[model samples]
Target: MARIVRKPGLRRRGSFRDWLTMLALFAAIAFAAAYLGGSEPLRGRAIVVDGDSLEVNGERIRLEGIDAPEYRQSCTNSGVEIACDKLARDHLRKLIARQDVTCTALGLDKYDRTLAICRAGERNLNEAMVRDGWAVAYGDHQWLEAEARNAKRGMWAYGFEEPSDWRKDHSGEETSRVSAKESVTLHAKRMFASLIAWLKSLI
Candidate 1:
């Protein structure tokens, strides 16, 4: 009978094969990701529906898949006006009450409202306001909601200084009614540009 010899420096042939198989699997996954990441955008009309919604240029138009403050509707946290109620009107006026905006309808919602995601130029308009502290994420969208919370963006940043809560102290007075200087407008424009640049990279 011949004695079997063991090679101390060599791994089992099956182990070598397993490593090769894993490398092949990883390569396949990377290839699939690159292949699926095509450059074409979704088909739609691309029109701004509101400060946060859009009407794509297709047969369908819908609110982007982001929840913005209902404006006129309200939510409360810690017994304070930490949510947007009819105040959503302020967002509309401040962001898109008159902007000739556009969107790329991506999908639809259950109520039949277009559930498309949208953008303004290269920036996501919905996200812009949320990030600017003008609005808050609505519903249970933990991802964006978390972003808003973490960045202290939107009403989340205001914390206890929410307009409604302040109204409790001053009887819902219009703070925006106070006039400001030209520098304020210039500062806002600059901030908007910065926000757009940041958001374009998101898509």
Candidate 2:
């Protein structure tokens, strides 16, 4: 058999420091892999989509489960002034104006909008809007339910204002004699400040 002589120290096992270095290296590699995987979908050129929304390379992202005021959707209904939705959208836009926004996307939603929790630097856009009465927390389940509930923000402030769903109030005595479409159109013109004097009342 060939002689195999080892130095006394060379034969010794690795110390705690050596183990720690190995462990840290492995941990760092694992962490990097996880981070990169998590960040893949959310990476892209960001475009603003209203207050609580943004586009990741043109994907419509709703700020997580949070619901901002309905904007560019329905402003008027059947000629009854549906002002709350307009108000909510306005407040949200102002809150997130020209901020460096980052978002953690969960995935695509039913509406095809990316469901994400947006952030403006340090502030969470979802929570901020709800906290400031700028938007509703959206859906029954939310991370910051207490903020909207206790603060009575957004739709909570309006006892009569129903969100997204307006059918809940239908089938009762209509607010005015005008049709819903006519009312909505009339209000839209007024909101843009172009409603004529007779046109306003005719609806």
Put down candidate 2 lDDT per residue, 71-184, tens digits, no spaces: 443334455554665666666566656665677755444344556666666777677777776555554336455766677765555453433344334434322223223333
lDDT (Cα, tens digit) per residue for candidate 1, span 123-173: 566666656655444422446656767887656654434433454456545
The 10-residue segment with the lowest total lDDT in model 1: 175-184
List per-candidate RMSD values in Å.
16.6, 21.2
lDDT of each: 0.47, 0.54
TM-score of each: 0.39, 0.49
Clashes of each: 21, 5
TM-score of 2: 0.49
RMSD of 1: 16.6
